[model samples]
Target: MLYQDALLERLESGLRKSLPQWGLPQDAKVSLLEISENATYLAEDGNGEKTIFRVHRPDYHTEEEIRSELAWVAALREDGVVETPRTIPTEDGSPLSSFSDGEATRYIAAFSFMSGKEPDAEDDLVKWYGELGEINARLHTHAREWQKPEGFTRKTWNFDTIIGDGALWGEWSAAPGLTEEGHAILEKTAALLRKQTDAFGAGEDRFGLIHCDMRPANLLVDGDRLGVIDFDDCGFSWYAYDFAAAVSFLEHEPYLPDLMAAWVEGYRKQAPLSDEIAAALPMFVMLRRMQLTAWIASHGETETAKSMGVPYTEGSVALGETYLAENG
Candidate 1:
């Protein structure tokens, strides 16, 4: 589900006016890169320097929240915790800039393009997951120690926030292809998950702010350096949720166990991991799949949701059943 022609035209028109405010030349080349949670565009300046222009979806995040996100990103860069693209400010010196068409307001931000290729899923992803684990460990360490600015606000991905009435995306019951059978299986899985997460508890070490979206698509590889992008979904959650997000849509992959082991090993290289946390990896994976199922149902117009359709929801049910059989 690509954006409608009218919506694309309006966004493009806004970009034409907005680029100059970001200090790009009049002849800058602009094109839509992706239209997922947000509409992202690529702008190439006259000198061939590329910048990513992100047009945030309306009502998802307020200006203060977006600023809070950038504040953490800046802290990560300054502390040398991980490699991330740098945000470029508007002429007015505000990190977040916006324009509204009366119908909807689009908050925009610019980031210098970091050069790298996304890892191929068909190729060896275990090694990539290992690197990602190390990176996530560093980020978690920073999140534990870093001081947040006043008014710092971000959504929490706690159990209730995910499966309850106010689920961040939507309830799993509404996901596509969810028959009575599918719902029953997922509900069981969710109950077990709630029990496990509750037992684990949200102690300072186990739960905190995290990059909730850490899939391969959000990762960039340049030689030995692994760079993470797309902090839009960053917020408070179980730290192991990051590992679950690492394997994201690939939960059903046959090599998942190997990938999980690799991630845990890599993570342990930097931070301490308990056997209890390691034992709960499968639960986290199933939880991530269920969350994605709800996301697909709620965001039916996005290309990912449109393409996933019945197969994705059905797969989630299968995964849920397997998780219950093994973990329940």
Candidate 2:
């Protein structure tokens, strides 16, 4: 059974062998920075050079699924449209490596670290999310050319599971200050989405490889360039959902038509959106909000998460309150 330290040592060994091949120095002493549920480490050479090493979770996928993930990124790189972490093979040139905690661990892969700065909402809000929108555009563009990987299947994004079925609202109604109105909103919103989700199946609206999670945290900005990471959630899905995600998460400035215009402008430079996409953006915003709202509502005071109540449900209610008071 490989322990965490032993697994890391194995990862370091892989990096020591691979980075130099990418033209990194032999004197590189890689400094490991962050490790997510999917393990990644940052290694720095003597010249302060850094690259990311990835350890894929075999529990989450098959070797084919792993191949599909990198292939999607590689396809985009080939098109000269985006920056994907260069996959560094093992000593034998295999794109992925398998190891065990003996407790059933997963497949892991290593990559050359990408460079960039993390954007923040507290500082320059609009610009920060706008940058995220640009990266989303780039990711989905060349991604359209990539072949679907062998072991991969469609991902639900769980939108319907999270908010529909009345069972969903039933599951979260006991939390403090949760009202009948919020529950009703969840039921109604989910119903509306379900009836329309497949309304544009795999057409221009549904086609393309989507970076399912386009949250601001996954992006890196260097000067005017941006890099995106965390593609474990990548899959074939609605192209507009990508826009919906970028628009919602990065809507730092007031949610207005002008800011939406800026995002559309930047996204078009990579892959343009259609009129269908434009019309659905507002509903997508509503859907993402409610999904997060319901998730938080179910797990109030989760030690690691920020809030416990539904976000959009309460938010819209408060906005309504404000509107009514001013008018009445």
Model 2 lDDT per residue over 1-328, tens place: 1226776676556556555554566457666665433556676766776666666643556677677777766666667666657776656667766655457645656677777766664445466556656766766755665565666554445444435554232243443455887556545555566655656455644466788666655667777766777677676666666755654433323654555666666677666777777666655655555554544454343321233334444664453344334323
- lDDT at 90, model 2: 59
Question: What local lDDT does model 2 show for residue 159?
Answer: 46
Clashes of 2: 7
After superposition on all C-alphas, the RMSD of every candidate to the true structure, in Å, is 1.5, 6.1
Q: For residues 52-114, what per-residue lDDT tens digits would candidate 1 score against the true structure?
A: 999988878888889999999999999999899998998888898888856888899889899
Q: What TM-scores do the predictions have?
A: 0.96, 0.70
Cα deviation of 5, candidate 2, in Å: 13
Spell out the clash pairs found in candidate 1. Answer: none
Candidate 1: where are CA atoms >4 Å away? none
Indicate the TM-score of model 1.
Answer: 0.96
